[model samples]
Structure formats: C-alpha cells, structure tokens
Target: MNLTRPAGAVLLALALASVPVTAARATTAADEVNYVALGDSYASGTGAGNYSDALCTRSRNAYPALWAAANDPASFSFVACGGAKIPDVLDDQVSALDEDTTLVSLSIGGNDSGFASTMLSCQYSTLSACERALATAGEYVVNELPGELDGLYATVRAEAPDADVVVIGYPHLYKEGGLCLGGLSSAKRTAVNKGSDLLNETIAERAAAAGFAFADGRPAFAGHEICTGDAWISSSNVHPTAEGHASAYLPAFTAAVAGS
Candidate 1:
C-alpha cells in the first residue's frame, strides 16, 4: 500500500538511535532461534488486506512475521488462528511452540469476552443497549482476562522458558469523534472505538504484571485514526489495512524487541 513514514515516527527513530545494536549471529547450536505467535484475529492479520488461508484467519504481514523478520530468527510459525480464545492459547499453541523458540508474541482475549460478536450486536441495538454490551465485555476483561492471560503465559513459558514474550495491544477504533457508516450510527461507532482504549489499558496492566513487554499501538495511531489518511486502523472497526499495519507496528515493535 506504499505507506509513508508518519511525522512522529522521526521521534521513534530518534529514540531507537540510543539502543545498542546486536550482531545477528546464530543464537543456538542449530543456529536459528524459533519465534511463535499466538492470539486472535488481530494477530492473525485481519483487515490487513492479506491472508494466508480461506478462513481469512491468517495474515501474510502479521506482526509476528514482521518482528521475526527484523530479528532474523532461524524459524518462525504463526499458529495464530483467528477467533482463538485463552483456551486456544493453552491448548492449541503447543503446536507452534518448540525448544527452538526464543521469542513469543500474543494478542488475545477479545473473543473470549465476545467483544467482536457483541460489537456486531451493538450495531443493531440502541446506544443504551450498545453501551450495555460494551459494559458486559468490559466486565469480562476486567474479571476473566487475567486468569486467561495467566494460564496462557504459564503454558507458553512452560513450552519455551527462554523466549522473550511481547503482547500487542488492540488499536483505537477510529478517528476521535470521527464518523463511520455500518449497521451502527457514527456516535455509536465512536463509542465502540473508545472502548478499545479501556481494553488496551487492562491488557497492558496485566501484561506488565505478567512480566511481558507490550507493543503499544495507541500512540502510534494517534491523530491518524481509523478510515482516515494513511489510517492504521480499518474502517470496519477492528481490522487494519496493510498501510495501517506497517505504520502502527513497525518502529515500536523493533524498539520493544530487536532494533533495525
């Protein structure tokens, strides 16, 4: 999509200037470190204008592949199927984890609480009803997300104790006070958009408690909101365009893990 560098990206580049560079040598005897990604649709690269399978569940330019490419790891597997819940992580993630794994990234929990499904429902309901749905989803994240995260982390760590784990937070829904037309009104669309921040904050706090790094996508998309110029977020509320993916992901991901 030919994404240009956002203006503030210079600031990120400047911050990146300070970190010491690491030589990309083989880390293990087999010579390549493995990287595994687990999570839901966001991690699967939805709305990024690219997919690897019919379910449209996998993205060709998923952040894991992007991060792994920068790290130049020995092997990488994006077992991040779409609509994966915490249970999926605990049970299905093993196929992706192995002794060679040195890095991991997770973006999950929206599905377990049914945010996607509920959001779809919100589109048809009145504002009060939509808010109620959001509140319910919030309750689940506030209450159950932690347990799910803890379990998933425990499982991932058990499989790859030495891996550096990073969790990518969900992006903002749209331009602040912006408008979009779907089954919902512009105001309701904005409301749902703002709800994502609450979700990210909770996710970040839990990630910190779990001792994992976070690739914050909020500030990266500040000013530039969904369905806008060089927009990093998709018009559909949750997906990201290829351009959006690169802008939202790039520098922060490298800053958190390996630097360019």
Candidate 2:
C-alpha cells in the first residue's frame, strides 16, 4: 500500500512520532539531577567563614556550595544545619528531598556520638581521663550510633529513592604521635584521633550496607590536621577551614557522586 502523502504532512507525522521519545529523555535527565546537601556542623560549613545564617552557619565556601558553583547543576538545596544530630536531620532536613532528587551529600554522626563534648572533656584532663572519655565515645559510636545512622539512611533512601547519597566522615584532629600546640596533651590527641577513626569506620560500613557512597576525609585532611602549621581544620579543633571544604571535602564528594 503506497499511498502518497503531501511532503508537509509526511514531515508532520515524523515530528509527532519523535515527540514522546524526546520528552522521555528530557524527563529522565531532569529527574536524575538536583544536588541536595544535608548533615551537621561540618556539612554546614560552620568554621568555613562566610555564614548564610547564624542558625545554620552554612558557609558559601562549603563543599556542597563549591561543588554547585563548579558543576552548575539545575538546582541546589543546602539544607545542612550546624549542630544537627541524626534525630534533627530526620525531623528537619528530609523535607528538602523528594523523588526527583538525584544527589545528596551528608556529614553527620559527629554530634550524634557527642564528638564536640568528647574533645572538650579531653582538654584539661590527664592521659588516663582522656582515654576513658575516648573509650566512652568509642562505645557509643560502635554500639548505638550505627543503628541511629542506619535509620536515618533508610529515611533518606525512602525520601529520595534514586538519589546518590554520599556520606562524609570526620577528619582526624591531630597527627598521631605528633607534637600538639593546643591544650590537648599528646595522649588526648591520640585518643581523639582513634575515636575519629572508629567513627569513620562505622560510617563507611553503614553507607556500604545502604548502597550509598562513602567520602573519606582522613587522607584528604592528612597533612592539614590541627597541630600541623597549615591545618585545614579550624582552631576550634572541630570544623574545617574554607580551604578544607573547597579542596578536600569537595573533591572527595565530587568523586563519589561522579563514580555513582
């Protein structure tokens, strides 16, 4: 059956046939990309300098912000809040996510196991006292924190089912067995660093179990820890510098998301 049609009509028919296919591709691309940031002080860029708000302390120089500036994604939501614990993330931050979200970067679990308090307690304490404090922190990290984190990961997965979640771990505060200038004694520094290792290990395991990516800051923050003259971590001994976020954390996160 070779019924001849006008050239215009034939062209119109071909165009109509292509519309649905083109639309499908566009939808897929749109649904799979919009970066969302979520987590605690580190993620919020507390010590990175330029604050978005006093409440969150989200620095414009944070890794998520830097990544967005570089990649120019279709959209970006920086919902990470300083001092956010796992429970707070569940309650507050998950609202930023939806099915369409395709990327997520998180730096939580520090506050969950009382990282700041542990460090504070280590100050003005003997080696024995510092070790005891670290032991307590390590117990919480291994024994209770994983389940809490797993529950949060489940919630995040449910909210943005298809998003590539990259879980970032804390940096070791001081060089192991190095001379520390801060109030922390050598023993305290060693203990705190050990606690940091334990936390990172637990976080990496949970991320693996949940099919998420883990961005390790240990190697990146290696030469730039607290006691080092060119430390990337802040004087407060907790958060990263603007340079830290831009260089170390940003690269680690971008690599993870790209690999995914």
Candidate 3:
C-alpha cells in the first residue's frame, strides 16, 4: 500500500541510465543496418567540414555520415577517401564490406577521369586545348572507365549480395542555359558539364548492369552548381559544400535506398 518505488526498481533505473546510448542502439542488431561507405572526395566528406581524418577528410557532415546519424544504423564504417579511384575502392574500401553488409554508398570515377586535371587543363588552356582535353576524358569515360566501374560494382555486389549498393555520381559544375560568370568561361562550363554528364551516364549504366542504384546528383544540384552564386559545390570547383551534401546528395541517397 506504500506508494514508493522498490529498491530493485531504483537500482535498475540507475543502471539503465548509466548505460551509454550507443549500447541501446547496438542492442537492436536485428533492426540495425550495417552500412559501408566507399568512394572518392565527395564520399569522403572533403568539403563537408568537421573532418575526422586529415588525409581522408571524413566528416560528420558528409552524406554517408549524415545518413548514418539520421538512420542510426547498427554499425557504420566511413572508409571513403579523398582522391580515391575505382581501384582504391577495390583495394581498400571493399574490405569493410561482407555478406552482412546492409547498405553501401559510393561516389567514385571522377578521379579516375582525371577530373581535377581535366578541369585545370580547361581552366588554363586555350579553348581548343580545353576542348581536346575534355574530348580525351570523354574517350576514357566511354572506352575504359565503364569496365572499371563494372568491376567495382560487381565486386561490391559479390561481397554484399543482399546490400543496396547506391552508386553516387558527381554534380554538374555549371549552370546550363544561364548567365555564366566567375572563373570558367561559358564554353568551358558547358564542356565540363558534358564530361560530367557522360560520367554520370556511364556510372548509371554500370550500376544498372551490376544491379545497384545510381544516384545522379545533377538534377538535384540544378541551379545550385558552381558559378550560380547559390552553388553547393566548393569554391575550388570540386566536392560539395556541407549544404550541398545535405540538400542534394542526402536526398538522392535516401530516395534511392527507399525505392530499392
């Protein structure tokens, strides 16, 4: 008849309160997801800020990190590295995956296309030279890079057979059919966007062939590309700002995984 909590009840409450929140999260292993992040600078959180590693630049603001935090996956591994190419994923990041993996998010192939060098060449060279450089990159994209993506996606599928592997593509670096300003000329911007489009197409194809979802970020990033003044990409022209990742990349990934 006494309205008092029992000693055992109080002790149990205290014990539960003392246990860390992560333990509570880990307890639901059956409902928890095992997410593995793989790919290049964009996936590595380079411009997202609050880097966990100087070399890899993995950030809490990166899309994968944002997704993990929002979803509270049972376990999450951020292995994506800045400048990682397809081979980098196969050689390093793939080890994080296994039969138990539930999800994967990747942004690669940009570096493989020598994206930075191509952009630099376009920026510094004459119009014809820039055109030629982009043409060459397009050749690699059409001729050689599909095979690389095929092998990478295939390996990811083989390793995590049941996982939803979402392959993320780069954003167009310029606004189309709009007033262009800043560093890149209208012609260069158009060429850059073309190369990006080709890369995205190839990636989407390979993802489809490998039975993975490809998250094309160009449409999501429309009107927000570099030189738009509302750009989500970093000033240096590559990688997304934190807002960019949150706005474009995050939504794309969420929708792809949801549809999957």
lDDT of each: 0.73, 0.87, 0.87
Candidate 3 residues 175-205, lDDT tens each?
7665655567778788888889898999999
TM-score, predicted candidate 2 vs. hidden true structure: 0.91
Clashing pairs counted in every model: 1, 0, 0
Candidate 1 wrongly placed segments (more than 4 Å): 1-32, 178-186
State which candidate has the highest TM-score: 2
Which residue segments of model 2 deviate by more than 4 Å? 1-32
- Listed per candidate, the RMSD to the true structure in angstroms reads 14.0, 2.7, 6.7
Model 3 whole-model lDDT (C-alpha atoms): 0.87
Pairs of residues at least 3 apart in sequence or in different chains that clash in candidate 1: 232-244
In candidate 2 the C-alpha lDDT for residue 100 amounts to 81
Better of 1 and 2 by lDDT: 2
Alpha-carbon deviation at 123 in model 3, angstroms: 1.6
Q: Model 3 RMSD to the real structure? A: 6.7
lDDT of 1: 0.73
